[model samples]
Target: MVHGGFRVWSGSEPDFPRQAEQVRSLLGAPDNPALLPPQFVAAALTGIGGMLITRSRADALVDAAFALPTRDPSVILAVRHAANRPGATRLTLVARDRPGAPDGTLVDLPTDWKAQESVFATDSIAIGEPGSEHAKQARQLQGQIWQSPPDNLYPTWLYAPVCPASMSLVALHGDRVVGFLLGFQSQPDRDGTTVLESQVMGVDPDYRNRGIAVHLKHQQAIMAGMLGIDAIRWTADPLQAGSALLNFGRLGAFSRRFLPDYLPFRNELNRLPASRLRIEWTVAGEDPRTELSQHRLHLRESVVPGTTCPIANDGPMDLQITPGNPLIAIEIPSDWTALQQSDLATARAWRTNLDDLLLRCLGEGPDQYLITNAVIHRGRVFLLAEQATNNLLRLYS
Candidate 1:
């Protein structure tokens, strides 16, 4: 095995024939002299190093390493290698299969992958409607105390008073509530100048890849423009990929503060380490209308109700189209609170099964769909779809 990108030697180099015999025995290759070459042995060792270091290897190696019965072994191996790397911090990547390819499947590196950390995005906060199911889910997962007569349960209202006015939008999915833009109406230093603040944002364990949080923030920015918020400000965890991508790569939200564990509530509230990040958003010259439009369109397409297979019986589904083969969407809840507070072994077993099912469906065809917009209302999940060629597909509940 290679270590730190270098090969280790146990003793003097063994003769080619002897080593070749060992390789044949281990890998089940033929022992014929003509069947093996000295160069081939060298190449095999080099390939192993490449696989360990750069994680660049053939599909056959993936199959051999993972021993997967089905599914794309190459992609799976790549993800596994990336995920298992020592000292890895986060992993963020948009699903390659999303209708929007490279642009859509935005992935951050090791920082965002940690099971304990929660992410908040200022962008998501701007777009989410008050009192939506998405909002309720976010609130519940955030571990915030919920006050209720059971019927008068508006979680958003709980945070409304303390939440900044510039933060007209907020989004919560999975276990993290993200996309909070904070600002005040008047400031002594800059009179009449509006400020933008990204108060908090994150992805729940179960809701990472669906892009629900990102869509929420994009929508919020658009809403800010319309509402004449003028400016936006927020903070991020400097070590996170999603934060870097959104603040620097996309919106150009500049970092203004760098203190260790700046957000005290975050540290006291959760078990993970915290870092301070402050950003400012200048709404002027930023056109968020297009982003808002795309987000709404994608949100409509992705949202699905029900948490498991055989779509639950619930409210009206907007669209429903079955492909040539039966397509099913199973919801696996992996939020931080759920994982931290529940039976991990059982949850993992369920997750593995669900992932297997999803991969199977993906292999079916381009017609296969994974919808995230389905809302769970009254103990049922709702799904939406439209028909395809030669199939009477309409929105089914």
Candidate 2:
């Protein structure tokens, strides 16, 4: 079991090896030595054998990092970052972990800075492929964007553009990149009907509430139209009232397909049974924007909401879901984000219940019911999707 100066871990070894073993088990791979870098393993051993750090302290440190609600393997990145830094223990230890990343400009850009088309431009932020001068700044921004408000952990999946076809647009404020559209053009269908999947799009918290998200989305649509993509599909937590308003009310996207626990609940901001509603931005369909506008007006005018599911501060539960009603309305939390922060247990309960109800409302495919609009009335939010024909695809046609 001995390897020159150090022997491999045995169950007999005290604190470090045992604690390391604990971390390994928590990681769901007790026998996998590949889980950690050699330095981390050595650090644990040195601390254990030397009796420099207590098991309690070691346990606390390990738990906090493993507790990141992520299986991103960047937990090791967090560890490596911590180990490399000689000083600034508090800063390093408290730092958000990342996967193995490189410094300097990325070498794998799909399109050159000059050749990439400029999608959108406002007085403040412009969306395009930024030049090399902004790489390090962009890197720093990526790390900071998650720790901010609105949506945190979702941005972790979007660490610089992962998709193809130049859907990777960066929002630049002067020389610094403030927002990023980590999107990509998905594969074409049989008729070559293109689809653009918006993986993750976010503006810096400091730069939010300024219509930056709107600008990015609009620019993406323009780009999609130019490329002749039929629709843009994206997923979002149905609890986000603001996002619901923007996507359904403003951007003309609808949730006809409800995916139960589709997103992994690994992020701190996320709740259990991570259900998401797939938003379809039908760019070329029967004018969703115009229909949405009319739907909004109708919601305000005279159309009575047939069914209502009462949702409380604790979350939606013990509910009544009326499927056959022409216009069914399900009440949602006014501020689900705040609700999750205050009491997550209630949030989890709400998520689990909402999953089945939403799915029942919006069936599987073109053969099922389709959602038309989302309306907010009298401090209550209602999903406005009439039970369409059995062949729902006809509505799109």
- Candidate 1: global Cα-lDDT? 0.34
Scored by lDDT, the top model is 2
RMSD of 2: 12.5
lDDT string for model 2 (218-297, tens) is 77787778767778878888877777877876676766778776643244446465577888887653353665456556
TM-score (C-alpha, index-matched) for candidate 1: 0.33
Best by TM-score: 2
User: How high is the lDDT of residue 272 in model 1?
Assistant: 36
Model 1 Cα lDDT, one tens digit per residue, 1-397: 3333322221134553354334333333332211222222332222221121121144222111110000111221111122122222111122212211112222232211112222334433223443333445544544333121222122242233222222434454333344332222322124544333334454554445656555655665665667565665554543344445455435534432343433323222223334334455566534446553354345444544333234411112212324442324333332423442365565344334433333333221355442212233344322222212122121110
Which parts of model 1 have CA positions greater than 4 angstroms off?
Answer: 1-127, 132-135, 144-155, 158-191, 266-273, 285-397
